[model samples]
Target: MKKIGVFTSGGDSPGMNACIRAVVRACIYHGLEVYGIKYGYDGMIKGEIIKMQSHSVSNIVQRGGTILKSARSTEFRTKEGRQKAYDQLKKHGIEGLVAIGGDGTFTGAKIFSEEFDIPVIGCPGTIDNDIYGTDFTIGFDTAVNTALESIDKIRDTAASHDRIFFVEVMGRDSGYIAIQCGIGGGAEIVMVPETETTIADVIKKLDTGLRKTKTSSIVVVAEGDEEGNAAEVMAKVKAENPKNEYKVTTLGHIQRGGNPTATDRILGSRCGIAAVEGLMAGQRNCMAGVMNDQIVYTPFDDCISKSKPINQDYLKMMNILSI
Candidate 1:
């Protein structure tokens, strides 16, 4: 039987463990020996490999983070490092590899597959959900929900004190989490990187809302929002309305770590199993994504080159609801 290897690279996400479990179990169920790589590309370079069995992955479907761990290794950028990883693959007779990560992780997998003829299949696992091929990545749902809950909690305090609360959510380039939570939690203002939010725009929106009836406001800001940091933006707003009162809370790394939500668990499992099936079918340099409620394998090159834009239709719906 051919041996298959799986690893999670880049930042840790809530549903990574679920993806790992799904990949391992899927491979083993199909009579393929499964090997787990620890610490992402760093482990592959250092040959930190472990064999995985059904018992090894038991009850991990609901867990958070990756069992194999992850890292951003500069060494993996070098040809020598990749060569070492390829050599390790040869030594272990791992003919196929399933890599779970964002775009960077897929870049490495693409190179390894091309250079050594080792089949590699990638699964979109980032909470950012910025990957092109997939409509939704594994951990995005859970992250959005987590942000929503935090915003809800913050709203309680804002209402009681008749204050404005600025809640910062994690999203470097993409505002998927911020947008979802903003709409879900009934935020008064949302600052996203996709569209630069000006101080005037915020004032106008909040003034409209304030004139209506609400005594307080909740503003959801993506970490990459324009006009400097979210704290600074909030400060500027506070300056305009000193009596408005406002507090800034950065969710930071907390959004990245948590047990996979129900949606994430199910999504990760389906994506993982689909990845193994794709590789077993001799597919290489492809990413597994969910589209139209079905798993579709798209070429890695297409996935990397394409841009996944935010759903403006949903954004418009959110704008209506916010009013």
Candidate 2:
């Protein structure tokens, strides 16, 4: 491909700028023109394509969030909207695309490529770390560390007041963040969506800790847990044990910001480079992913259709170590 385009779609994640940088520079290095599509598929539909030079991505490897920005396009979900996006690509003479985002992003790219016969590649770029193809998606490491840091701070206050804390992290439908942060943060109980965690189970764990004379404890819960978020879980726990002192904190978007970690930057760069190289090698409708520490191309269909289950081993280790 002589000229190609790149965009970040769906939710923004840390290390996205780094991914964009790698795509831009990698394309430029291969003597190909790079175009940046602002605001994701919406930008493509609106013809918001801009020529990207190597300097356009300079000094962004350490940045958080996406330089091209991202948005969910309700319109892009329709056939007419995708036609408009394809027309824009034709107007810019863009021959291929690199889409960076989570499941929704890959689903859109997969359909668009089939509809237009265009070459497209994907990069796993979400804090959720739930993308199927990659062992660890870009921004996951940074987000986990951010939540761990926050939990550490909260622990101090919980200890000072001799209270229990319900710490919530991102992962609306997945528990990768919660599981990692729970173990790393030394949480007494880690609740995730992959496995059912009941209020009685929580109370039982708390009672066990209390009987052992533990003064303060942290329970990390995924936002998508069946039992609800930290606040809801804490409310139920408090209702059952009114004498217990409990506090709730939703980490919210705080885990999505800040400079990308070194691991994320490196992963983003590797995936970005692989994406452009894959396009040059005539790979289409695939995502660039790192599996077992090696760069690999995964078909978009598999990525979207398959579910990446959380490591049961992590859950087991969390249980054993949290004691």
Candidate 3:
């Protein structure tokens, strides 16, 4: 408990630096030596750890992405790799750990915590917002806004050109960003992976709303929708409705970058401090998350095994509100 480590793994996300800042400062405030692990679990095996000071994390709260950096460590998947990482921790006297990332990060942390004597606490840092314990993940709000901003701009061009636009947002495993931006951008149709909506349905809706009545319109689709991304779906729709003008825009990693919004900074800060405090409280193999505006810890197994479902009402709202 006197010395601890923190690292960000898997894909990087906005507000992660704020989380790292909070974690480093909080540990230092509680009179614990903090170590920064670079390049995630891979860094542990490589012994790429450095002691952090109060100033180490200063002025990073406004920044996007993680200061500690993140990566998926293929080597860390093996038992031998994990043992090496454990030995390095023992060498550095790091008693506990705070891991930041999405489900992949938590899955690794859970296995490592169970295998070794060291304890670990995770922070949800994915843009997908699919983690079960918390109402929102660290980067989801920022990602949604980022994608929405693009949709707003695309809407202007969509109108100017008198064309239908298919805008793709992130979320391969979840449809959060697409659903949120779909409603917020006032799209004619929204497509997600969770629902039973089909490409045929999208085409029919375009015919009903875009082909005849409206000169321009938008359709927001998640990357993981049953048919395909925005481009593929647009192709199918274009083929069926040959007279309709169409354009495809994949928002891609633009949603992943950019400085986090005010909401994300607060969430990251809260989760970061909670993680450090949770470790001191003898809580292990769990995640620090904000549920209903209060800090709560959920077991890692539950966070990983249970999937957070999207609001069905949000999907339904699109049906009534969009038309």
Clashes of each: 0, 0, 0
Sliding window of 10 residues with minimal summed lDDT for model 1: 237-246
lDDT: worst 10-residue window of model 2: 63-72
Off by over 4 Å in 2: none
- Worst 10-residue lDDT window for candidate 3 reads 204-213
Q: What tens digits encode model 1's per-residue C-alpha lDDT throughout 130-195?
A: 898878998998999888888889988899988888888988788888888888899877888887
Candidates sorted by lDDT, best first:
2, 3, 1
RMSD of every candidate to native, in Å, equals: 1.2, 0.7, 1.0
TM-score for each prediction? Answer: 0.97, 0.99, 0.98
lDDT of model 1, residue 229: 63
In model 2, how large is the Cα lDDT of residue 78? 98
Q: How high is the lDDT of residue 293 in model 2?
A: 96
- Tell how far residue 255 is off in model 2, in angstroms: 0.8
RMSD of 3: 1.0
What residue pairs clash in candidate 1, if any at all? none
**Pairs of residues clashing in candidate 2:** none
**Clashing residue pairs, candidate 3?**
none
